[model samples]
Target: MKPEAHYNTGPNELYLDVRLLQNLSGTAKWGKVLAVLGFILSGFILVFGLFMQQMLQSPGRAERVADVGLSGFTIVVYAFVALVYFFPSLYLYNFASGMQQGVQERSRQKVGKAIGKLRVLFKFLVIMLLLFLVLFAISLVMLGTGLSDFSLQ
Candidate 1:
């Protein structure tokens, strides 16, 4: 095998450098902000869902909601939305914190974990989007079929 032809094909190390660190720092800061905002939004949604009854207690509010076909399940839907929004926020927060720590300490392991979390977040979001898309398509198909059947009758 002729001693394997020793050549230094570089891919062994990645230089972080100051500029890259700065950029990562900026991204981490934004991620933290977005995470915090997401958490707050989820909290607001949960609170609103819980308090939906009280909010709709006024004169015709309940009637209007009922007329719109959102009478009872409003709270459930809002709670579900809030719950769905919370995980991505949590992942973003963890990624941001880990990335910041990694940048500060120049730790590859920390950065890798942070990136892993980001990947998880993206995967989660994409899966959720796909589910929602499918759900929407199914709903539309059902609605169209129902309307056509009604029209035929």
Candidate 2:
């Protein structure tokens, strides 16, 4: 008979190492910086979208109904993109804040909440990555079909 290895699984054992805490603190600072940058970028995108819409609707330009509709669609797409960027940043910011507070106060609940926010951010990223991959595959298929249709005699 083989002897079983003993393992220490006490509830009082430290789950987080000191090194990890240091790293997390650094990450929180960077996250704050990134979140601010994302907000700035979203603002710029919003301004550009509005500017584009206005340019398309300017009285000096002879705008067709289709052109106006297209501009509106473009603005909508821009808004969606801006929202996508904004949301993840918001989550990241929250995580950073929670982690900072948790560490400062040595509160387990705050740390858990911070981890939860991080999970949400990761989930959103994974979904976006999958969506982009699917879109890329579809584009490749479309391009291949389009190229096939343009063969010279």
Candidate 3:
């Protein structure tokens, strides 16, 4: 059964005005655009990574890559990076979709789900940021101690 008292006075309940709905709609549109773009870019990256090994089969590419201390593993890393890029874009898309539906239907549950997806996306970004920071610190320490040569080589 649907509640007929959508406009009832509840202190903890949120009231979405016209302005808020417009804003949400706009945000959702933008988010959808960016997510689609991200998906396309990630697809390109994965395709490139997969075909890189075949490219290396060509004349001098493998030798050049070897000279740079890179090997077949580098292709795997590219694909991994692409996969990493994909999840956040997916989260953003889900958030956008949920928000749009919630606004259209005036469904608080859908909006809440959208917010949850956004929160998860942020948490994932923070974790990735921290991991990169730690890696940067380690790299700096290695360089300071003149151990970069040993590590890289």
Please report, in order, the local distance difference test score of every candidate based on alpha carbons. 0.87, 0.81, 0.86
Where does the lowest 10-residue lDDT sum fall in candidate 1? 5-14
Q: Is candidate 2 or candidate 3 better by lDDT?
A: 3
- Backbone clash pairs for candidate 3 read none
List clash counts for every candidate, in order. 0, 0, 0
For model 3, what is the C-alpha lDDT against the true structure?
A: 0.86
Cα RMSD for candidates in order: 5.4, 5.5, 5.2
Model 1 accuracy (lDDT, Cα): 0.87
**For residues 26-54, what per-residue lDDT tens digits would candidate 3 score against the true structure?**
99999999999999999999888878766
Instruction: Provide the TM-score for each candidate, comma-separated.
Output: 0.80, 0.80, 0.80
Off by over 4 Å in 3: 1-6, 9-14, 63-69, 147-153
TM-score, candidate number 3: 0.80
In model 1, where do residues sit more than 4 Å from their true spots? 1-14, 57-72
Q: How close is candidate 1 to the true structure, as a TM-score?
A: 0.80
- Estimate the lDDT of model 2: 0.81
lDDT of 2 by residue, 7-32 (tens): 33244222455898788788888988
